[model samples]
Target: MLQTMIMTIVAIPLVLGMAAALGRSRLPAPAFALLLPLFAAVVSIGIEGMPAFPPVRAAHKFPYVLAAGGFVFALVAWRMRVVAPALAAIGAAIAIGLPAWWMGANILAGNSVKATTVAILAVLAIVGAFVAAARKAETPDGAHLLPQAIFATSLASALVAITGGYMGMAMFNGGLAALAGGYLLVSYVSHIRGNAQALALGGVGAFAFAWVAFMGLVATALLAPKASMAGLIAVGLTLPAAPLAAIVANRLTHFPAALRPLINGLIAAVPALAGILIAGLQFAG
Candidate 1:
């Protein structure tokens, strides 16, 4: 776990630095966003001594599945533009649902019915989030969606660590948050230099949403049976909070444009706080 943490911390900066360099080199925004998180996931798995590809058990196979699915969804969003979220929902449903079904069959054979129910709920949640994110991505000032998604996922991931005692997963989430935050910083630099229009691309929003939803589903699956259902739902709620908050924030016509991000950040933090409270209760019990 300590090794995982160290590797994640190191890899985030390295990947972000490379991403920033690439951004400065006039790389397209969609490619930049898609590649960075994918690279981070690969680096994370490598550092954890996990195989990139293996005919392994479903429990051990989800990270790779999510990574690939996220990339494909991101690409679809980049190319299709109009129906990106719908496409992403289909991909995410398959990627997340298949592994969940496998886990249901193999690990929770005694509770296969309940497992199937959970898998269905998970797919629904992910598809819902994708739709919400897709709607937000269509707005003119949707750049803030990416960072908000990243931050919310980071918080939920940390909560999962608290609930499940999975330090490696926590570190992986931290690395993704760091990468997303760093990318925003780099994008700001690009915007300042007049190289780009906004801090994020619509395609990146899809990628970020997919990544968060995938991780949330994975965390819930791993932790829910052991933890309180309320706590698990609290954590799951964080996945869509950011995009939803962004929608509200965008509608705040009274607020200054420059202060919108800060307001959105606060709104996003609400679900995180709720998650932390639930986690603390679970730990205390």
Candidate 2:
């Protein structure tokens, strides 16, 4: 009951924050969007009333670590050109080391081996994301990655929600899902500036459809034990399928000239097909 209420309260801010961030050209938009998730996290902490975070297990609250890792990577990347190779090397090392330390800590604290592994991988992803961002920031078009970053972070939050639900961290999953969905919508829409408002509106509409469909599946998993079966179906069918369809459609419509059919075909085919196949198996069974 509390979880549902909290999710309801958090949803409004999450959606609005995402919309605002997506519309803005400056960094503050994303900054503000970022806060919505943090706010959710804070609310979750209060709800759970867990005394002190358990020794941070992997596949758990690792996104927090990833956020921090990205920060550290960006800091190191700022000095990349000066010590080019060395900076890259150090960044790579820390990327590897942070997970190692995280896992070691989890193990020492008696976390499950699987959880420890997931935690490390999450940290690595966050670090890699940062390192990429840092390296790109040095280039003339580094700003382009912002959209991708928003996308990546949104995806990460979705994954967090799924994993958190599996771990019985119900509030965490709901809050994270709400926040991630909101931000992605805002960032993606905002990136489509100076275009026809109609087209932008259409794009947002499509994204909202996808977002709602996906989160509905996730929400079910968190909120209902029996609904896990339905959640599985939705995830397998909608999650990858929706995104793949949207990406392909966008490319065909707006980026027809820029679209590399063969390349994009392969890019879209692999995952979309895999997602369908996996879903088919689940349905079959």
Write one digit per residue (lDDT tens) for candidate 2, span 1-285.
766665553665366446544543443323432333344434444444433356344433443543444344334334332334344435444554454455344342454533333333334333433344244223212222223323332333334334334433344444544554465455444334433221122111222222222332333232322222322333323233323344444444445322322233334334324433443454345
Candidate whose TM-score is highest: 1
* lDDT (C-alpha, whole model) for all candidates: 0.56, 0.38
Runs with alpha carbons beyond 4 Å of true place in candidate 2: 2-47, 50-100, 103-174, 188-251, 254-285
Evaluate residue 32 in candidate 1 and report its C-alpha lDDT on the 0 to 100 scale.
57
Query: Where in model 1 is the C-alpha error above 4 Å?
Result: 1-4, 10-14, 17-25, 28-30, 33-37, 52-60, 74-79, 84-88, 102-105, 108-130, 133-137, 141-143, 188-197, 216-220, 223-228, 251-258
- Per-residue lDDT value at 99 in model 1: 57
Candidate 1: Cα lDDT at 152: 62
- In the range 128-194, model 1's lDDT, one tens digit per residue, is 5566647743564455554555566565655655575655556556665665566556655555565
lDDT of 1: 0.56
Give me candidate 2's TM-score against the actual structure. 0.44
Candidate 2 pairs with clashing backbones: 18-182, 18-186, 22-186, 22-187, 22-190, 58-119, 59-118, 59-119
